[model samples]
Each structure stands twice: as C-alpha cells, then as structure tokens.
Target chain A: MKKILILVVVALLSATGYGYYLFQKPSKDIATTKPYLSTIAPQLIAKFGSGQTSSSSELLSKVIQVSGKVTDIEKGKESIIIVLNEGIKCEIILDKNPPFVKGDYLTVKGIFSGFDDMFNEISLTKCYIVL
Target chain B: MKNKLLIMLITITVFGAFAQNKKVTRTGSVQFLSKTPIENIAAQNNQVASILLVNEKQIAFNVLMKSFKFEKALMEEHFNEKYVHSNKFPAAKFKGSIPPSVALDKAHNYEGVEINGQMLFHGVKKPLIIIANIEVKEDLSISFSSSFNLKLEDYDIKVPSLVKDKISEQIKISVATNYK
Candidate 1:
C-alpha cells in the first residue's frame, strides 16, 4: 500500500508539471533575423488591421519598415503623429523629442504593436529620418 | 436687361433654398469591447465624411476607420492588428433611408426613427438596420444614437479558439454627431 501511494503521488506531480509547461509556453514564433526592407510598406502594414485585435501578439516585436508621404503632424503630450495617405497615421513616442514636419516623406522602422482601440501603431525602437 | 435680371434672381433663390435644406455634417462613433467588459475605445480620425437627407426618406453616414482609440497599449495593438485591420481597408460607411413616417423639423425634437441601410466594413458590404434618435436642434446640432451589431466573420476575421468565448459575435455600436 505504501509503494502504491508513492507511485500515485509521483504521477500526479508529473501531470501537473506538464500542464504548467503547456500554459507557460510562448505562443509567438519570434524571428531571429530582421524583417526584409522590401516586405515593409504602407499598404502591407495596413493589412494587419483587418482582423480581431487580439491577434496583434503574433506580430509584436517583429521589425518592420514602412514608407509613406506625411499628411499631418500632431504634437502630443508624450508622442508625435506622422500621418500618411488615406487617414493611415503612425504615432512615434520618444524618450526625447524628435523634430519632424508634415508633408515630409518618411520611412520608419520599428516594432509593430497595437495602440488605443483600433489603432495599429509602431513603438519606434529606431526611426530613420529619410527625406 | 430685365429678363437677365429676373433669371439671375431665380438662380440665386434656388441656390439659397437648396443650401438651407442640405444636410452638411455627418458623424458617428464605434465602441470597442473585450471579454472583460471594458468600454474604453476611441478613434483618431473622428470626422463625419458625408451625409444626405431628403424629406426624411433618405439618410447616409460615412466614417473614416482610422479614428478609433483605446486606453491600454496592449488592447489598442490587438484592435488594429488583430481586429480592425485598418491598413487594408480605410473606411466604414452606412447608406440607408429613414422611415417615411418620421418628419425632420429644424425646430422641435424628432421621434427616434428606424434607419435601414447597408454597412460597409473591411471591404465587405452587409445589410445593417439601426434605430437612431435624430433631431435638428435649434437649426444647429444633430444628435443621434443607434447601436448595432458588428459581426467578425462577415469581414473574414478569424478569432482564435483560446479567446473565442470572450468576444461577442456581434459588437454593439453607437453614433452621435454635430454639424459644423
């Protein structure tokens, strides 16, 4: 009876360990290499907004480069907005202020993340000031 | 000279009459929801694009999709990337007519009328019917409120199985606008 109880306890512990492993595992498949420049475009990035907001996790931390003509400039309390065509805009929040104006052609590289409801904004890890 | 003067007067009167009755401003709001019952979503491009009102028989509303906003950073990210996919399609529009029995007066509150129309979201067009309480208050403000369902699958949105129970099949939407 003692040996049987010990075996049962061990089996229960192993089952609990396996359950925790599945729960804690990361769902995302992170890419070691940086995303190709050609793959990043205003049109391509805009396609990400077509589905449910919860799916953004799949694209988080992925490097992306987007190019578009600046339409408007919004200076906010914590960030700046660079608007592209067709009401598509990107908000860049900085540790320090970055100088930019509306209508300046821009190419930004950052990690794609979601922001204020229904917004797919990029957290700019690095911004390339391309005229 | 007299005939020319008469024609010019007629033209001016006609233009003025049309302008007085024209429905100029159109605006709306789309609320975002999660399973947690949080009601804090907004849009940046919150301008009403176009409107048409003819004898209370026809009405239309158009909204730019880029305007929705949220409070939390993570929620907002999921909204655009996972839910709205605003990058591919940029606009949500409603075109419909009001019930004939409802009268729109420049003064006095109008009864809440049922608006039947087609709602275009994520490039897919679907039939949408909403009840809106619209009033042309003091010849200035146009107040409206109508909540409707937004189906995810209608626009090809695939909700992951893990969180499927958290989201509703039809999202409730409310809209309000004031003329410029």
Candidate 2:
C-alpha cells in the first residue's frame, strides 16, 4: 500500500512539472538579426493574410526587434507602417513617435500587439529606431 | 524628299522600339529558412511578379504576406508568429532598379547584374544590393535567381538556442515569374 501511494505521488509531481513547462513563455534568446540586403536580394517577403482573423492576440505585449529597409512608410492619423521584406511587413501603430520614410534603413524594437485584420496593422506600445 | 521623310519616320520608330525593349519584367523569389525545408510559399498578389516594380529608375512592388503558405502548420505558425509576425507586419515591398547595361532580351543565359533597392521586412526598411541572374526565354518570360545570407536578429526574429542551427543564417531565394 505504501509503495503504491508513493508511485501515485511521484506521478502527480511529474505531471505538474510537465504542465508548467508547456505553459512557459518562449525565451528571449531566440530572437536573431537578419541583414536588410540579404532579406530582399534573393528572397521575397510579404504579409501573410488579410489580417481579418482575430488571432495573434496572445502574442501581444511581447518585445521584438526587426531589421530591414523601409519600403513604404505611411504616417496615418494614428499609426505607422514599416515594411520589412517583401514577404514580411509590420504595421506599427505609434503611441509616441511618427512614421519612418520610404528609404530609411531602420531597426525597430517594440512589443507585438493586436492589429486590424482588414488593414493589417498592430498597436505598438514603444518603438525606437535602431539603424 | 518624301523618301527621306519615310526614312526618318522609320528611324524614329526603330529608336522607340529599342527603348520599349529596355523596360521588361524583373523576377525573383523569397526563401524561408528553417532546419526543415518548407514548401508552397504563396503570395496573394500574383499579378505583380516581383515584390516591387522598376521603370527606368523608379521601382515599386506589392506583396501580401498573409498569402504565403508553408506545408507544416507549426512552421507556418512560427513564421507568422515568431519570424514574420504577420499580424503586426502585413506585407513586404521593394522599390529599386537594376543596372542599365543588363539587356532584357538576352536568352537562356545567366546575366549577372547588380540589383539595388529598398527591402522592407518586419516593419523595418534598409537599402540592399544583390547579384541576380536574368534569363530571357523565347516566350518573352523573364526569370531570376539569387542567394544571400540573413541573420534573424537584425530583424528581431527570435529562435531559441535549442533550435539555433536548425535555421540557417543565410537563406537562399530562387524565383521565376512570367509576364501576365
């Protein structure tokens, strides 16, 4: 009876530990830098969808840094768009500063927040030019 | 005098034809880097071949990132979530030009030319130069291929150390586009 009870307790502890591991957030070390020239020269980067889906909210509030050439920089009434590569473009809704120019080589560091699906944009809490 | 006028008109038409030939389609591709190769990366705006367009000296291309596809659901998720973050950054574009000496009529041979343009990714823009091979076919289709190295961190693409080598620092891009 004692052996069976100990086995049960061990199993409970292991399951709890595994559950915590699954729910843990991703490490920051995973973020890496890619050169702007390398991004466009041989590869094509573009947006994924129409942004109509209400997903990606769970990843909001996470800090990120991306480097690339500014293709189209639009300073809207309340937001900004800094396109990365032909395949990947990020819409940063600025709470502080204005948008970048079309030719500016910029490095943006900010949190990934929610965006409008139709327009394809995200609300940026903090953004600073790196390059 | 009438013959001279006709000759002058023919000369003008010939010159115009040469100028028209100078302007043609530029083609290329976008490669996604992961330990495993992902297939079927699609762009919604297929009507426009490349990311941007270039005429004489001006350039512009439009690409819908949301349309790009990957075979694996997890990789696609990581691409939009971890690498590209498609929700925040919706599209990628380029506005630049190729060298003047490169002829668009060249057939079946790799014409190495310098491509200079602005590459926008993950909400950042930077000037870029790439070596590309331009191939002109009998059908008047233009195809291009080039390869370059990229670091994920420059654009804030986070990949955990555990799977670091699984992804390559430099991604190779192969592209082919036909005029519509």
Residue range B37-146, candidate 1, lDDT tens digits: 53333433333344545455566665544445444445545666687676555457778887776655555466557788898888889888888777767864455656
DockQ by candidate, in order? 0.05, 0.03
Candidate 2: C-alpha lDDT? 0.50
**Model 2 B-chain TM:** 0.66
Docking class of 1: incorrect
- For residues B7-52, what per-residue lDDT tens digits would candidate 2 score against the true structure? 9999999987655444333222354443345323322112122422
In TM-score terms, which candidate is top?
1
- Model 1 agreement with the true structure over A1-131: per-residue lDDT tens digits: 99999999999999999877764554232134345443334564465545334544455445566777776655433345555552334546454665656666677654453332223332222234443
* Fraction of native Cα contacts reproduced by each candidate: 0.00, 0.00
User: Chain A alone, model 2, TM-score?
Assistant: 0.42
TM per prediction: 0.53, 0.46
Q: TM-score of model 1, chain A?
A: 0.49
Model 1 vs truth, CA RMSD: 9.9
Query: B70, model 2: CA deviation in Å?
Result: 2.3
